[model samples]
Target: MIKNIIFDFGDVFINLDKQATYKELAKLGVTEVSEEMMQVYYRYEMGLITTKEFIDFYHKKFNIAKKDLINAWNAILLNFPLHRLEFLKELEKSSKYRLFLLSNTNELHISWIQNDWGNNLYQEFKNCFEQFYLSHEINLRKPNENIYEFVLGENNLLASETIFIDDTKENTDIAKNMGIHVWNINPETEDVVNLLNRKEFL
Candidate 1:
């Protein structure tokens, strides 16, 4: 029986245009993704660099304005459907399983979400989870075994009793390898509000 539920934030709860950031950056002359750029991004995601440093790297490398760069960086984020929150709240109220949120998110994206959703709505969503782990905040990221281990160990959760839901196969694959049940949901066709009704849980 699955007694713990772990969810990915993007696409699972909040809609995202994953290509929007790259598209917006291309407009600012960031036409190519260099290895260094990816390294910097990985570091930023792990909280190894400050937001200022992240912005500054692009500002200097692409000669893009701070405001424009910030806008491009945040373009990947879209809307958070309220229905998902309602479903999550219902799950939380049931108290049948411990809930968690684990996402590979950076500070700027999180700050933008807080600002866009307003404090009340953001807090309401957050309150549904027993532990909310953001990559930057925790210095760990998905598709990494240690992160999965950390979540399980810290919470004293059994992998066999946990179900991890994510929109990315790369992430879910790692968790699945560790013996956790997974739902590699396709956001284009599936909605998290229908979670329990899915075949895995049914």
Candidate 2:
């Protein structure tokens, strides 16, 4: 039986445009995504670099201002539907499973979320989870074998009894390979509110 549920924050709970950042960056003359930029991005996501260092790299390389860079960086985040929170709350209240949130997220995006949702609302969402793991804070990221191992080892969770839900197939695939169950949700048509109804959970 599945006794643990690990959820991805983006798309699984909060809505995301995914490409909005690219489009926004294009408007600021960032037409091409360079390898160095990608490396910097990955490093930023892993918390290997400071936020100021991240913004400064872009500001220095692309000649983009800090504020504009921040704006473009945060453009991907969208609204959180109330219904998803309700579903999560109901699931948490059941006490049937230990809940967790694992996301490959950076500081700017989280700051934007906190500002947009307000601390109280953000806490309301966070409080539903037994553990909240942010990639930057944790210095680990998804699709990485070590990350999966960390989550499993840290909580003493049995991979066989854990279910990880994510919108990205790559992320889910890694967990699935580790003997955990997964739902690579299609946000375009699938809603997390129908989780228990999914065949994996059933």
lDDT of 1 by residue, 9-76 (tens): 99999999999999999998889999999999999999999999999998888789999999999999
Tell me the lDDT of candidate 1: 0.95
Q: Tell me how far the alpha carbon of residue 150 in candidate 1 is from the true structure, in angstroms, after superposition.
A: 0.3
Clashes of each: 0, 0
| Model 2 Cα lDDT, one tens digit per residue, 1-202 | 8999999999999999999999999999999999999999999999999999999999998888899999999999999999999999999999999999999999999999999999999999999999999999999998899998998899999999999999999999988999999999999999999989977677
Residue pairs of candidate 2 with colliding backbone atoms: none
Instruction: Provide the lowest-lDDT 10-residue window in model 1.
Output: 193-202
90: Cα error in model 1, Å: 0.5
lDDT of each: 0.95, 0.94
TM-score of 2: 0.98
